[model samples]
Target: MTRAPATRELRAEPVGSLSVWQGAALYVGAVLGTGVIALPALACRAAGPASLLAWLGLVLLSVPLAATFAALGARYPDGGGVSTYVRHAFGARAAAVVGWCFYFAVPAGAPAAGTFAGAYVATALGGGRRTVLGTAAVLLILVAVANGFGLRVSGRAQLALAVLLVTLLLTAVVTALPHARLRNLHPFAPHGWSAIGSAAMLLVWSFAGWEAITHLAADFRRPARDLPRATAMAVTVVGVLYLAVAATGVLVLGPADGTSDAPLAELLALGVGGTVHVPAAAAALLLTLGTMNAYFAGAARLGAALGRDGALPAWLDRGGGVGEVPRRSLAVVTGLSGLALAATAVTGVGPQPLVLLTTGSFVTVYALGTAAALRLLPRGGLPHRCAFLALVAVAALLVMTGWYLLWPLVITASALGYLRRRQRRDPGRGVITS
Candidate 1:
């Protein structure tokens, strides 16, 4: 033989390098977050003890909602996730707008998650706006850096965080259960049955991340087999934990629960005596960081996929290098988060707009996803039946969100207008970044 070239052993891509248990852990991390910390108080304010019913109702709704996304993930299995499904079911224009809504929502939502944790941290170390702001900034930077390495690193970290969070939550529930008074539940529906709907709107944020988890379906060793199983496991875990915390807020904290932002801290202090501020603050931070990391990781992958697919400007697509991190996408995410945080800190504006925008964007995504499932999934089957129910439920939830829908509407219109202008000038340009 004169001269021969040696073949390179290609490095395997590390996208879907996850087991079922790891997948379940990641789901738990993403789904159980800041909502567990502060939203209970808001729910309690809206429906008193009846907020427990709101929690249960959303969990029940999650059954079909989770199934809808899991089926789509198993069948489609793409990094674009809900956006890819929307593209398949609707068209590119709609998909682009929806994708933009989702990508941008992280910037808005991450700050809210940060503030939930930051408030507790500030209180623990003696309250100050500067402490809250600094704590949140540190949280954002830490999560972004953790995810910048790769999915495997993020997934393992998430699993550990989820375990720690579950342990803390369970400890709180057990410690407080003995102090729970049955009489606290007597005036359950003080706000009336209509209040249940209001509470459900507030509580919807808590039940969000199941759709987000579908982005990582491709990372599972056997996506179709494990995705549904993982989802079911996650739902059970999240539901039990959420119900336990809400019960503690109502039964143990009673009237004070509705007003306290740090309901879990209050419950623990009541049960143990003395300020358990440090432990409470640490728990809140861990809970928020876990959730933030999950979203940052998923959105980074999604942004790269969108860039590669021409849905977004190709300049943003830099994560797919055999076995590398989504650095470009993460930089974009961190930048947006930084700006949003700065604005909020300077303007003294509340995070309600950002929260509403995130909720509305995701709700739109849910509606479209369930609609796609109903259309594409095999008819006369259980999956199809669940999709049908989910579609109806998502539509009703959208209406319940009311004027909040306007935020996503404006975003969609702006996105469409930009795409149209770009197309008019370029004629055949699409968004592939190579």
Candidate 2:
């Protein structure tokens, strides 16, 4: 086996049993989360029709960002993904911080995904916060159960779910386009052109899962060949879908798009001249499930990798294998996610803050990963220039995150502190490679 040089060999799991389409589905499922449902509305609210510019910009930005991570995953093809990249490019301590940030962030995201679906359900039904919170908790638990069966089972399910979600979303977008009015394009920047930055900040969260799916790239049947193709496929699909839906939301609903809770449903309703709540609700559930399932599955594997490295408890490393389920890690992730749901319920904090928190953590991880790509990719080349520009874009997005950046910062500090203590005590556990 060819080993990753100059560092401890990163564990490569037997993940390549999956097909190219499955790999594409993994990327799609990991990324097209519940954010797709409401993010268009939020962006429209922030930047009027000009939010379409934000959408276009992100789609363009995602090309480089997704390509950067795909190159890393193709090169490394390890369960550690970006964590391994950071470990090789920076050091063990930095990798641990990235790992900690990612592991903890998934729990927060679970609730966000659940709440997103629950909110749609609540709107259709007659429930409120409790209903949303309860639904979210149930969804998280269900995802845990589904992932307990392992990746082969979950990955196929995700493929079906992704197909379902994209079909439903595409149906709404295409059907509603005929009703989209040109007049809505006027007064496009009501909030001012600068508001595109704020809108981009909100939408950045939706673009976060590119790195998350890298954790699963090693599972692709042909990681080097299929991984980049899958990334490209997903990027194209997502960009078109996001742009279409966002544009439809603005055109069909006009100013109402921003305030409407269920813009996708609203677009369908406008097109068909009646409410499409049932199908919309079902689509929302699938979208939520796809996201929750992907993250839970990816995080479980990542947790086991962290455990094996002593970044987390060793017990998590036991009972793990490629394609085989990581039960202990699944339990830990599920338990933390349940706790996050409870915290949301108890504190009456809505999903927005949790979304922001998780997004902030992911942004931090992406920044580190992109920086690593800058170092790893050949110098003074197209790939290097792309990584450098991606680094700058991600840095700008992190700055836009503002106080939400606090969560990842605290996690990084805590991780660094822990590693410092461990290194001091052991004196020779593992060397931090540059």
Best by TM-score: 2
Give the alpha carbon lDDT tens digit for every residue of 1-434 in model 2: 11233333343544566677777887887787887887888888889999999889888889989999888887777667788788888767778889899999998878777888888888778588877887888898789889887777787888898899888888888888898888989898999999998888888878878888777776777788888898889999988888888888888889999898789889878776676787788888898888888788778888887777767766887645556677999899999989988887888886667778888999999899999888777788776787888999999888888899999989988887877777787767643443
After superposition, candidate 1 runs with Cα above 4 Å error? 1-15, 321-323, 431-434
Give me the runs in candidate 2 sitting further than 4 Å from their true place: 1-15, 380-382, 424-434
Taking the tens digit of each residue's C-alpha lDDT, what string does model 1 give over 255-363?
8889898998997787777889999999999899988987887788778777876776777778643245778988898899999899889997665556666888888
Indicate the residue-level lDDT of 406 in model 2: 92
Which one is best on lDDT? 2
RMSD of candidates 1 onward, in order: 6.6, 2.8
User: Please, what is the whole-model Cα lDDT of each candidate in the order they appear?
Assistant: 0.81, 0.82
Worst 10 residues of 2 by lDDT: 1-10
TM-score of 2: 0.94
Model 2 superposed RMSD (Cα): 2.8
